[model samples]
Target: MTGFEDEIRRRLLSAQDTGRIEGLLFHSTAEPIVGRLHGDGLDVLWTARDPWVSAQYIPNAGSEILLARPDDWRLKDRVAPTKHDVLYALACEMSGKECCDVEWDWDGRAKSWRVPDGWPTYGDVVGHIEDHYGYVANSNGVYYVRESAGVVMPADWQIEGQVFVALDDGLHFKDVRRSGEPDLTEREYYDGYAFEQAMAQGYDGVIINDHCQADDYGNVPHLSFGLNAIGREKVEWLALPAVRRHLDPWYSGEAILTPDLDEWLADFEMEAVHAL
Candidate 1:
């Protein structure tokens, strides 16, 4: 069960049965695997490209290698695996030690983090330990882990002090703060979030991706993403013909108003078509 050939085959079958086959890369062999790497002539067994990513066992099935068809193993540009992958994180968690240092690229610049001396090894820790400094990317890959003092940024880049979660988000640099002070900070803004800024200031560029949208912050260099709705809770609305203005007492679901209800309103002084 540990490293047996049959066990490996069984595991592969299990993956196929579970319908989790996306990046499957298996080498087929007309002959059957009976023993170790020498017996089967295959040295590698169940290994993952990265810890977080799905585990793709080496192609060793039939005589031909059955890989994920859509998968471009022969493609020119293949993604490289990182050492601080999920396995490293799990190992760190299980061993109670931090693992994997990730690298980052900012504004067409590469950034490296610095680690401290005498750090604990993967063996020293015993269970899942948390590395607070390392940032797990959207791909679940760890990067820029610095045990000494957080991620190492460029000498020219100002330290924002706060930790920013790397997601499909955009940031901006403004020249003023709400307290009417000169703002030299890297501010974050997105679609739904812009509503608050716009309501407060009467203008905003971060949410809409335009000139200074926030009247309070005024016009400034906006470094934001092309995200659709910045800060509002996105809701699914069915677009149907509206009969009148939405008059639902409670905001339960969509209110598709119709313009056919009544075109006349009764007023004490004003005459309507009904009066005529």
Candidate 2:
């Protein structure tokens, strides 16, 4: 047995019970929790809740490990798993199988696994890092309770359709050194589709999530707009360097959408609220 596998066995055996084991898996951000002996390598999966996480990693050949997503995709260049990713990892471990490899057979329902067998285990490495943890909401109406536990909600948060949280992504931030609030320019960083769509739907207010200066991507500063209604918006915006830092972190919240809001928007008031 390799040191990694030996470590996982030691911890699993030391745990008080399966429940504690589950807790360890649920709360960790960069360690492997689930394991399996596979053909190519020893597969290990991680699901941690924290500043950032890999959620899954496999010790590939030559002392290198391949990182994976909770849904079993080989994740690349990402910092952490969202709440959903952590939950998925927990659920997989509970099944006594690797999350990414097996197609779960639960009461005839079709649920996918998040981790598969084929890499080295690193659960021990993640448990040692308590600086950050991921918090995933498990139920409807559970979000309110979770807020107290570090589940952050945006200011212009709109709970929409009892299924998802919607926001205008219009919270513009003035650079602390700036003399005044910046204005929207054609070349500035903004989600034109979100702005135009909000106007078309006649929403009472369009919330701006981020309006700040960024320099990681050369000199052309950019603005970021998040329209949480359509999930596609997030998928696209996650690529922006500024948005990746400021906005993507909040995408980890529970499925919530709030409407009938009266905050952070004035010019767009006296407008109708419609779902596009």
Candidate 3:
């Protein structure tokens, strides 16, 4: 066992004697001594063997503290865990820590906590399709065709009608008279359209798959979403419990003796609680 594992084991035993630890959670790579923390006043509520296991069971385990080890996959290659962030955020919230609030940099080697760039945006939905083809506007509706495909203006085209203008490889709609200018009407239109569609379907927000390769390197293709104004309000309302729990002193990292196991742990720890 590494010295860090020994330190964790020692702290677990010390916390057990003082009753500071009520439950424990660890990654599958953790040593047997870590598991020994259980069965003696400390209930081992979870042993995260895989991402799915952690997602399915960790929320149900009301562990007072979490001690996670790095996953085996992360050690082999530094693949980005796109899907795991939500689960980690959920876990952090469950353990009374606010997710993405602080910059968690452990030992200067792990990814820090921040809103991921993978989150979808309006451009990803209606943007151009590389250098070859893009969306163009007409009376019939928008259609994806070869760039500058010699599209003749429709008979009904008017000065006030919507027109497509390409800027930064994104399709932007504008008033026919202002086609030469780049403005934000396209974003407003799409965001409003997405909001309406989601509301009509009784959803709080819209999840979109980004085909534009906008995600961080090594991340798998993942679904991303944005909450409309009303959806954001509803989420904030529902998250009051988590916010309060994060503020509760009882859930603070004071009881976890190892500084590395505290709330300061970075985003990479989501897979394995221990630093690699």
How far off is residue 106 in model 3, in Å?
Answer: 51
lDDT at 112, model 3:
51
Report lDDT per candidate.
0.25, 0.25, 0.28
Q: What TM-score would you give candidate 2 relative to the actual structure?
A: 0.16
Model 2 clash count equals: 40
Better by TM-score, candidate 3 or 2: 3
lDDT by residue (1-276, candidate 3, tens digit) is 445444444545555367463222222112223112221111111122111111221121122122133333433332222332422333333335332533435544335544343422223222221212332434443332221123322222211111110011111111112233324342222444444555566553443332111112221222223333333333211000110011112243333333223322322245355544
Q: Rank candidates, lDDT, best first.
A: 3, 1, 2
Model 3 regions more than 4 Å off: 1-192, 200-202, 211-220, 237-262, 265-276
- Name the lDDT of candidate 1: 0.25
Candidate 2 lDDT, tens digit per residue, 104-159? 45554335434444321333212211112332223331212112123322222322
- Listed in order, each prediction's TM-score against the native is 0.13, 0.16, 0.18
- Rank candidates by TM-score, best first: 3, 2, 1
Best of the candidates, lDDT: 3
RMSD of each: 29.8, 26.2, 29.8
The TM-score obtained by model 1 is 0.13
